[model samples]
Target: MREVDLDVFASELAEGAFAIDVREPDEYRAGHVPGVRTAPLSELGAHLPALPADRPVYVICASGNRSAWAAERLEAVGVRAVSVAGGTSGWARTGRPIVDGTDARSA
Candidate 1:
């Protein structure tokens, strides 16, 4: 429903914000924020309990589009979620820590 910058998202994560990567498993396997959980938009409903409602859930993907849509879906289902502006690509470019199958550090 709202937007957040990569740096702000990073700081929020540091402060314990709940982050979710609403991308395909393969895409997420390629790369993602170090602490974000993989909660694909396609199956967000059944996994709603896995998300913490007390805090805002930050959503991200390759770009921000899908995450934005996912944010809307999350809103429809009463979950407070926001799409990070520019998503993972922006996070990567912002020098935030990320993790992949073989790498688990800043990029």
Candidate 2:
């Protein structure tokens, strides 16, 4: 699976790239990158049909591991996806804005 560092991910995010948080709901509720939708890795298959076919999906998790796996899954099914290296933890550590709660749209 393709991977991108936080800086590239952040730049693309600013351009409105699609992103999915692959961490579980509780973890996602605790904190996440602003505007990222929840699609926990466990239920990812169910979300496939709804994913955009024309754009690259940026996948993230608490750390980089799960997102990497999620990205591979997405790629196997013809979706272009990239895992965010260092994931949300790195994003938060770098002081990027984080949103708390289940509301993915609350930015």
Candidate 3:
């Protein structure tokens, strides 16, 4: 599995990379990156098919732990996945704007 710093991931996201938040619904509803899809870690297997294989998928969580686990699982199945270092917290600390509940998905 690979890992990307929050700063680098931000640029990749801007360039159209796919990203999935693996946090639970409540956490995600509080705030998340705009346009990022949600696939809570608990249900990742079911969501796997929906993720694109042609491009890399970036996984993130409130911190990096859950995403790291998800990235490893994805890699085991041959998806080009990377875990976001520092995760969503790092994004907020960097002053990135997050989309709130209106854009959140049910997990």
My TM-score estimates for the predictions, one after another, are 0.88, 0.95, 0.95
Tens digits of per-residue lDDT for model 3 on 1-107?
99999889999999998899999888888999887889999889999889998989999999899999999999999999999999888899999989886976532
- Per-residue accuracy of model 1 over 7-59 as CA lDDT, tens digit each: 78878989988888888777777888888888877777767888776878888
Query: How far is each candidate from the true structure, as Cα RMSD in Å?
Result: 3.7, 2.1, 1.4
Which pairs of residues clash in candidate 1, taking residues 3 or more apart in a chain or in different chains? none
- Positional deviation of residue 96's Cα in model 1 after best superposition, in angstroms: 2.2
C-alpha local distance difference test of each model:
0.81, 0.90, 0.90
Of the pair 1 and 2, which is ahead by TM-score? 2
Q: How accurate locally is residue 55 in candidate 2, as Cα lDDT from 0 to 100?
A: 89
Worst 10 contiguous positions by lDDT, candidate 3? 98-107
